[model samples]
Target: MTTLLEGKAIRKIFKTGTVETEVLKGIDFQILEGEFIIILGQSGSGKTTLLNILGGMTQATEGELHYQGQPLHKASDAELTLYRRKEVGFIFQHYNLMPNLTAYENVKLAADIAEHPLEVEKVLTDVGLEDLKDHFPSQLSGGQQQRIAIARAIVKNPALLLCDEPTGALDIQTGIQVLMALKQLNQNYHMTILIITHNSEIAKMADRVLFLKDGIIDHITVNEHPLAPEELTW
Candidate 1:
């Protein structure tokens, strides 16, 4: 598999005056194209920090990052903005959809901003939300709302999708539905996906699992045969 992104000796620190709190300490990893990667860690384990850096929401305090040979670490704010706009899509734990907009409209809003976007209706159908696309966010269930958020992210036709605790807000069954949608996206669109979560069951569905502990990757596990999302136990 080809390398989609690479990080070497990456570190991040948050400083408040004289106080310094180090989050990521010399992390290194490579993400492959079309792979479903899970970064598993407990809270305060720097999983979100690492994801933020990888997604271009923030820069590393030290070391290097390259995306398809582009020097992300050296990229200026303008360059990073372009990189994020053109190459990456993000999904958070909270579905950040506009309450006033219908599912289709919410997704179309993202597609409008993207340089090369997929058809909004097609992306909605891909996530099994075609029937509910006309419904407002408040009219949908949590899982349906999340699927809308997933549709919004994928509509950008992004090469990489970064999700931070995507299913954390749902019940076990609902979480399974969201995971199934993500798995389908991984298989059908061949989008490289990186999800950071503490759920061990969720890790079973990943092609590769990066176990993070205390600001460093504790170990890396590659699943020879990954389970489908529905096969996971809550």
Candidate 2:
């Protein structure tokens, strides 16, 4: 597989007056095309911060970030905006759906802005939410809402999907179902997915698992055969 994204000596620091705290310390990694990568870490290990930097949601304090050989770290604000809109899709722990919008509408909102969008209804059906298209967020359960969020992100037909604790708020069964959907998306669309979570069990479903400790990658393990979501146990 081709290298889709690369990060070299990435670092993030926050400055509050005279105090400077570093969150990422010389992190480096490369993501291959159509790969499913899991980033595992304890809380405050900077997993989310790394994901944000990779997705261009924020810039790294120091180091190089490249996407398909283009320098993402050097991109201007407008370029980053375009890159995010056209190439990257994000799914958060929270559904982040509009309460007033129906499931279909929420997905459509993202589809409308995308340069190359999948059919909204097709994506909803892909996530097994065809019947819930007209339902609002309040009318759905946590898993159902998350499936809708997945649909919203995938409808953009993005090159890379960045998920931050995608199953953090659900029961095991529901979380498994969501994971299965994500797996299916990666399989069917050849989507490159990077997921960050504290749940170590989720790592079994990934092509590669990156262990983060204290803002640095401790090690990377590649699985010869990743298990399905149903086979995972917490």
Candidate 3:
């Protein structure tokens, strides 16, 4: 598999007056195409910070970042904006769907901006929300709304999909459904996915797991046979 993204000696520091807090301590890693990776960490472990840097939402204070060998660490703000629009998809815990728009419209908005977009209806079907595409966000359940958000992200045909605590606000059953949708995107659509969460149980479904501790990777593990989303409990 090709290396889709790479970070070498990455570091991030936040300065608040005389207090300088180092969030990422010279981290380094490579993400391969079509791989489902879970970044496991507790609160204040810098998981979101790393995901932001990887997705071009933020730049690292030090070290190098590359996507398919193109430099990202030194990319201009405009360049990063283009990179984000063309190559990356982001999903946060909140659905962030426009309440006034129907599910189809919400997903369509993303497809419209994408350089290589998938069919909006097809993407909705892929996420198992085709029947609810005409429903508004307020009309749907939390799980259904999240499915719409997933559809919106996937319709862009992004090469890299970054998710942050996607199931953080969901119940067990609902979270399982959301994970199934994400797993389908990774296995069937072959989308490269990276998810950051504090939930250790979620790690069982990942192809590889990176354990983050105190702003650094404490260890990494590969799941020889990852479980299905439904197999996950807790």
What are the lDDT figures for the candidates, one per model? Answer: 0.95, 0.96, 0.94
Per-residue lDDT tens digits of candidate 3, residues 1-234?
999999999999999999999999999899999999999999999999999999999999999999999999989999999999999989989999999999999999999988889999899889898888889999999999988999888899999999999999999999999999999999887899999999999999999999999999999999999999999878
Candidate 1 lDDT (Cα, 0 to 1): 0.95
Cα RMSD to the true fold for all candidates: 0.6, 0.8, 0.6
Better candidate number, 2 or 3, judged by lDDT: 2
TM-score of model number 1: 0.99
* Weakest lDDT window of 10 consecutive positions for candidate 1: 225-234
TM per candidate comes to 0.99, 0.98, 0.99
Name the weakest run of 10 consecutive residues (lDDT summed) in model 2.
Answer: 48-57
* Model 2 lDDT tens row, 1-234: 999999999999989999999999998899999999999999999999998898888999999999999999999999999999999999999998999999999999999988889999899989999999999999999999999999999999999999999999999999999999999999999999999999999999999999999999999999999999999987
Error of 2 at 91 (Å): 0.5
